[model samples]
Target: MSVTPHVVPGQYREVSDANGRVYRVGETDRSLLGRPRAWMVWLPWIAMMGVSVYEYGYSSAEAVLEHAHGWTLTETFWIASIWAVFQAGVAFPAGRLRETGVLPARTAMLAGAVFSGLGFLALSHLSNPYVVIAGYSVLGGTGAGLVYATCINMVGKWYPDNKGARTGFVNGGFAYGTLPLIFVFNYWFHPSNYKMVLDLIALGMVLVVAFCGMFFRDPPKSWWPHDVDPLNRGVSEDARRVAKRLAKNPPAKGQFTPMEAIRTGQLPLMWFALVCIGGVSLFGINFQVPFAKSLGFGPLVAASSAGVLAVVNGVGRAIVGWLSDYLGRRQTLGLVLVVAGLAQFGVLWSGQAHNEPLFLIFAFLNGFGGGAFYPLFAALTPDYFGENNNAQNYGLVYSAKLVGGVGGGGVAAGVVAAWGYAGAYYLAGGIAFLSALITVFLRQPGAPRRSGDGSPVAEVGGRTPSPAEATT
Candidate 1:
């Protein structure tokens, strides 16, 4: 049973497994050097780290940016909110182009690198709020979005056989890579040298992304590990182990186009849940440090708390991702949201009591849940919708963050001004709980969406089709 690809120049070829099932293959991992490449993982991973500072890394620097630019809290938040809009907005279009081969992975990375530099520069040199918003939010957001979407998609494509652990590892970088940067902003950063520091960071983004982007690429359609027998492990123990783990979470029956996925109705459900989850996360990112300060905590404690958030946020993504492989994506997601939602109350209590240790502990959990949901959705989109159009499907889901970002930043500011931190935290907790409740309804799209009585929706025929039924 030797499996071979029938290469028909310029079009998708065919490959059949031992089961006699046929697969359509597009561009594959075949390179001059070999079949498998480790750099495929490391490069996209490093590129994720490069663009990460754009979103998750901004809180510690927010105060300095506010002071350096002579802006009020509302104005500063507006800038951040706008950045979120553009960052999440660009994902689908950028991903569409990337998938169509109009914008290759390497090209997207290079462009993102340059845009990221100019975004930081906009803050350093521009004085007008309007000017800063356009320069940083539009340009920087798009740049970072392009890089972020590309990196996450790459992992899903490359590791289709086991997306959980790897996708989580890469996504974790987006949260924690700014670990050293957080400390820098805290201990050494000042208004006088802010411009110099930003310029350096801008340059660093270029160098790091450029280096990694050069190696980035996507796997062909219906691609699986070349040596692993997905249907039958035969005598290869490694393949057996790999296949066994992946058996729990199988790929979509077929590659779905973006429009087709939308028709399935899962995308909108994901969008709404993310809107709530992302808002809570971003609110924590933007206001948690300031909240600590408002409680009369020392600057060191404030900075340390933010740092703990970042480290735990990043580490939790990896841990949860690995955990999802065993627990399943939906279960892991529900747990994460529950923890995050409850932690908001803990954080609020710690602040009221001015309990430093309690605040730090809850901060760690907050960070953990804040970032974990992202990779879950990232992994889930392809799982439900199929991997071929993952970029577009995921882009639609990720775009919810724009709404969340606005609510978290500017809207949260208003919440603070109105009902105070207690009200805001209570609201955030409730949102997280709602998001968890939503996760409970998530079923494989092609499967029947269940009713309150546990009866299947008539059209879905009651369950996920077996892989055999899914295959054309």
Candidate 2:
């Protein structure tokens, strides 16, 4: 297909109803690309994968990296913690700029490519821990965060109808993308030649994020699928199903700005819940393999445990996202949280019993529950808050991961030091349980109020209310 610079951008438009719900519509990126085989979705997926190795593959090389730089384990973990901080910290601001059209998604990602490259170079050349933290954590983290927020937001905008599936699929990339890097670090990487390896990884990040990000863009806020009509009948079966889901869980009554979302009372709840869940998940990422190693498990068992966690973590995301379409996002979230909490104890059980097979089995369960909640959270942000300000809104919610990173990594270290792995695991399990209980109160703040006839409506105009019509 020939690309044309002369092709005009779509005009801004809105759809409204008397109940006062409004939707902003913009052209889909698929149309802009001349609908060339869903490249919009594929690009973000690849970009997500490209950035994944930085976070997921790091643990495998921790010992070599520490030896190369002569840093204590705590110092190394702090760098990882700080990296998480910067990575998550940038999401909100980036999302805000992207939504306001001040920072285009493509530009943000290209910048990420540059930052990511610099981060790797720093790791290769810098011997000082503090300087490495600044370079690897701040620079690398920001770069990864930019690509992450953009890729996540990009897919959400394009596939609002089946967002769960799309989000899950894209999110899955972040996990499994590190598979090859994990193998490389485990078997082939050595301190003697580590600089060259870091350079090569840096080079790969640049290529993937830059190439894929070039195609990145968003559907206009409030953009609805052109083929799916909520008020119309005789649409395709898929369209009908999507429409029904929308009715069951309506779009935001209005496109709320970030401050407006905060006032709704649910944002804080979501944040805290995610903080707990995120911390638990990160702890699993950081310590699960090491814990297995301490259990007299063989090298194969230890490596397999980590690999299973990473792979299953990703695969479960896609599976659950598909499940959420039927089960509902909140309900699915609670279910996953429960399982994740139980898995913590199960891992401890397997460790105490020195059950290698059992340990691996819990590792699988832990991995599944660990990541399945991510796409659900991503989907719920839009479902509850609306897509117009989703970048910023979701940014606020995702920022919980910053605090979570601190808890899961640095704070977890202190916990392990004082209480040992078994004690730390129990505490983590308790946090997960609390988060699951919190998921119970996750109703949308903008849901329509019921009238006398049991029809749901909002007082958009502040006029005298009429008798409610019957509703399903």
Candidate 3:
């Protein structure tokens, strides 16, 4: 039996497999974009780094922000909470617009650049919390979200064959990139100089994000690497390596539309897991510094803890991403979540015990476990669904962070005030454990499952599973 591919005129040729999953093949990145696709990874990475300060560095600057704005501690934390809400809230809509062709990648980046700058400016100038929320949290968060969502999806689109490592590398920039600024905000930032420092940050963000986004381009729909055959095995060494990876991390049975993905029930589970883990991660991001400081740790220990976390948070993503390629995404994700849960308890004990060295050690572990889950989920979405509609699918999944940001940031502030740091930390640790439990039920949408006897059973035999079949 021969398979006929439908050619899309000038773009690429599309071939459908037995399950009707389409692959647009024949065009190379060089032909379509004039440069290698590696740029996709690097450019998005730089852009992601530009916005890293929003959530990661905010903790370092919290004292200065509170003093400069004449706001209470609770007010300052809420700004970050609100910012998280908008930053995550925008992902789905931005992705929908991008997928629908209403928003071009270049335009989204440019807008993100301007809005990011405005967010900083709002932080620099606005004393009123509400106004800052309107200007910085709403506008600025949306900009950051656009850039974040766009950069992540861009890499996923460009590298369908090996998404785990590439996505993790790019995602890492969003964490570790704030390392230098973390120190600066802690030491050099004062109320008098805060305005200037924040202004400078805004300018730098605009330049970096705008410069990187100009070259942003999306690969054609269903695009697969030209050298590799997607549907069948090829003889080349590279193809053989890819084939092995595919066997372990099998592709979805077919391209699932967002609705279809939701119907499979896996998306909701992924969403729930994200909400849980994301809240814990965000709680750490927003409160780790304050927690350390409250225990009488010096400025250096506090800043250093954050710096270490940021650095490890980033590096760990790349390491685990590479590991997932060999170990499998779901298994790796579960392990990461468990470590995160345990690390939270470590952080609590170290903080309460006033053990500086131990605190940093737990911070290191927490950073490694905290941020790595993001890329795993990012890669998992496409692995479970298909890449054709990945931007939207991932947008839907990533939006879970909206709830996470609020719970971890603002609601967390209330928790800290009411229950104290120990109580909040305990709650966060419990949430992370719950997320790990949820990961157990996450099977690929239409893929095989192990039977009670440890033999493989075809769940749907490479066909889309019904909602009832998926839940079981």
Candidate 4:
């Protein structure tokens, strides 16, 4: 008996046999969209951000301690750098673990939250600097790494089409978390009972951890919203056929391993871009508070400025996210780097003048530049590589920022000690300018497609049909 094949409109594919009956191959309305389980995924991120904000209080405390206990600048720098190192080291492996499915996203998130709480709790009681460094820097850094990697990975998966926007939203949460803590710590702490402040931080971490644990969940593959269907349709049949015919087939679904990604040229280029941006941004964020203080601003003013910077940072991420969806990734990134370079130099000029309004403008511009870079890096990775290994890829790329945190922060402190704050500002501005130069070398990974149009339709086992035929 002979058989014939017929394609139906928005329904099952019909293959007819000589007997006059048909068999279906493709589903009529199988959903292709990916929706996350209701808001549960976001909770873990929000909790982690809260803990990060609480951790910033320690820096605020450091400023206080400098005056109260006569702690040296070296001591403060070491504490912060050590913490950044710990976060850098742990983030990649934690990402690898999540990518391999050894730990569920929620479970890892809970562990991070709990560990951070305990670290803060230890900080509250310790009198020795070594113990404070070990408990808060090392332990807290590890926990932060875990929480950050997992939250970013989940968000990337949840919004496959708009990785930048989703990651920007998550990063923004970290910034927002700082606002509340600024008020809380100021209202709660007293000059006489310094130890009580640590206890309060520990309590806050515990509550955040518990709330995250209760609510967080890894989005199931089937959870995508129905409305997003048009975006996630798998590659064209022709592409799949070509992929299948290759000597080495594309990695299995959810099987693009991290080890393989590192070997590709794309990874190194991506890493370089991240390092350039991360290095400059971290230096600015870590030193902005101290720099403000050195310029004759009181602790209250300095701390308040940091809080404002945090808000501006969040706004930067959101703006970049929206821009990435419209402009190709590489072009948008190049533009951001250019703006950041200008802002960094602006800071140099503003710091020397000692003009308040000019200083604030430069500060906000600098914040906008540094803040916007991270979300772009986060979104760029999965767009180049498939989502299968998103956690590991992002983790590896994120290490650049961690390195920047240490190098940039350390360099700024050393420069400030020798040349004064003006010199340090000049040095950072140079680095930001260099980073912008590097951005021009980066290119989009794939060919250009229609603007703001994500879906690319192709024919099954044949050339892509015309749009008129595709619609019919």
CA-lDDT, candidates in order: 0.80, 0.81, 0.89, 0.62
Query: Positional deviation of 364 in candidate 1, in angstroms?
Result: 0.5
Q: Give one digit per residue, the lDDT tens place, for model 2 in 133-251.
A: 89999999999999988888877777766778888888988888888787777778899899999999999899989998887767655666544543434356865787666654465
TM-score of predicted model 4?
Answer: 0.78
Question: Candidate 3, which ten residues in sequence have the lowest lDDT sum?
Answer: 453-462
What shift in Å separates residue 28 of candidate 4 from its native position after superposition? 15
Name model 2 segments beyond 4 Å from true: 1-13, 24-30, 232-235, 447-472
Candidate 3, residues 1-472, lDDT tens digits: the string is 1122332334445555555466766677787788999999999999999999997999999998988789998899889989988998888888888988999899999999999999999999999999999988999999999999999999999999899999999999999999999999989999889999999999999999999999999987777877767765577687688888887787777777788899999999999999999999999999999999999999999999999999999999999988898889999999999999999999999888889999999999999989999999999999999887888999999999999999999999999999999999999999999999999999987732323642212223234445554322
The residue-by-residue lDDT of candidate 1 on 1-472, one tens digit each, is 2233443334433444432323433333563114455666677778888877777668788888889888988888888889998989989999889878899888988898888888988988997999999989999988888889889888988777678888898898888888888878877789989889888999899899888887776766556554444455356676676666666665565456777677787878889999999999999998899899889998788888898888889889988888887778888999999999998999999889999999999999999989998889998888787777888889989999889989998899899889999999999999999999999888776632333643211111224444444442
- The TM-score of predicted model 1 comes to 0.89
Once superposed on the true structure, which residue ranges of model 3 sit more than 4 Å away at CA?
Answer: 1-11, 447-472
Candidate 2 clash total?
0
lDDT of 2 at 400: 97
Q: Which candidate is the best by lDDT?
A: 3
For each candidate, C-alpha RMSD in Å? Answer: 6.6, 6.2, 6.9, 9.4
In model 4, the clashing pairs are 34-224, 35-223, 35-224, 35-225
Model 3 lDDT on a 0 to 1 scale: 0.89
Better of 1 and 2 by TM-score: 2
Q: Tens digit of lDDT per residue, candidate 4, span 69-188? A: 455776776667777777767778887787667887778877787777777765566646688678877888887777777777777666553566667778666665666666555454
